[model samples]
Target: MSDVTPDQLPALPVTFRPGRTRTVLLAAGTALFLVITLIALLLEHLSPGERISFVFTAALLAGVLFLLARPKVVADEAGVTVVNIVSRRRLEWAEILQVHLRPGDPWVFLDLSDGTSMPALGIQPGIAKRQAIADARTLRALAEERSTAGPGAARG
Candidate 1:
């Protein structure tokens, strides 16, 4: 993804998700699970119950990977939805006070009207730093355009 300038915002209902990180995690997890399951099924030395247990354990590990791959930010006309590892939060345009992605931070954060900050793991600056910065600016622009109440209403 390229940098999104304030002058040319993308269409509404845009989604921001980590590009490489999510894919890598999901793929690795699936491969590992499959290898483990194959081993369990092919190893005749292990009892039937043991095979079941092994598959079950693999499934649990995959579930955890799915959790890690779950985070994303969806921005629509009305508001934005932030989905993290274990939580999902919805905020109206006005409810988002600001969007921040300072250096050294893991991901984008929304400073909410409630005085609490919420992490947006979807826009992480790990392997894709430029994309994440661009996404952060795009989200900030959206918030500012949606809720221009007063000064500092949508600072990035």
Candidate 2:
């Protein structure tokens, strides 16, 4: 195992997101929406209600794609903010007991002090395995470095 101890962590106010996935989803959603809209407009035989339904369907799909791309993790001086699909949570450094990305896991998981594990979807390994590993290491290092020395300190 490589030492996650970095020579230097990035400056504060750093943000990590699934860059490749986000880009691909956004582009695909936009393209799909446009294609559907164009077809709705060009199909002269369709009833007005059917055309409206097509556009609405396109909009709904695009919205779903946007939600899927919303997960991100932001670390600043205060703490870490984990934004998952349809939910958001802020945590103090000590709140995170450990960060793990086991083999075959979909994304990073934070074992919180409250005894609940929360998925950190921002650092997923779907299409960016290497990047996710590096990111998970960085986050682990940060949690260890920033957590105050106490009962809840993120020490192994």
Q: How many clashes in each candidate?
A: 0, 0
Maximum-TM-score candidate = 2
Model 2 lDDT on a 0 to 1 scale: 0.87
Model 2: residues with Cα > 4 Å off, grouped in runs: 150-156
Task: Give all candidate RMSDs, comma-separated.
Answer: 2.9, 2.3
Task: Give all candidates' CA lDDT scores.
Answer: 0.88, 0.87
TM per model?
A: 0.92, 0.93
Give the per-residue Cα lDDT of candidate 2 at 41.
95
Q: In candidate 1, what are the lDDT values of residues 26-128, reduced to their tens digit?
A: 9988987999999999998999999999999999998899899989999998999999999998889989888899999999988988888999999999899
Q: After superposition, how far is residue 76 of candidate 1 from its true place, in Å?
A: 0.2
Residue by residue across 17-48, what tens digits does model 2's lDDT show?
99999999999899989999999999999999
